[model samples]
Target: MISQTLTLELKQVLGALLFGSRRPISVADMRRVLLEVAEQNGDVGGRFAQTSA
Candidate 1:
């Protein structure tokens, strides 16, 4: 299961992504961003790996 703090963090990141986007974001787009973030910083704390969309 995802921790509460991680859930909040994910929401914040996703919100920021959507706010900055020029068009509607897709699930595949979101997953790509999430995976990229996970690969780059290792700070998403494996949340994507732990849970499903």
Candidate 2:
């Protein structure tokens, strides 16, 4: 399981990415961004499961 703090951090990142955007964000796009962040943080394996849903 991922930590609540990490989840909140990801939410913040997502919010930043979506803020002031003209186009609507898709699930795939969010997943991709999250996966990138997870990979960068060395939590890709653990985070992947959550993203699948």
lDDT of 1: 0.72
The residue ranges of model 2 lying beyond 4 angstroms of the native Cα positions read: 1-8, 20-22, 43-49
Q: With candidate 2 superimposed using the best TM-score fit, by how many Å does residue 37's alpha carbon deviate from the native?
A: 0.5
Clashing pairs in 1: none
How close is every model to the real structure, measured as TM-score? 0.67, 0.55
The sequence of per-residue lDDT tens digits that candidate 1 reaches over residues 1-53 is 87564333677778888999999999889888877666665655466544458
List, residue by residue over 1-53, the lDDT tens digit for candidate 2. 87565343655767877995589988788788777776667753346436663
Instruction: For each candidate in the order shown, give its overall lDDT on alpha carbons.
Output: 0.72, 0.67
Q: Indicate which candidate wins on TM-score.
A: 1
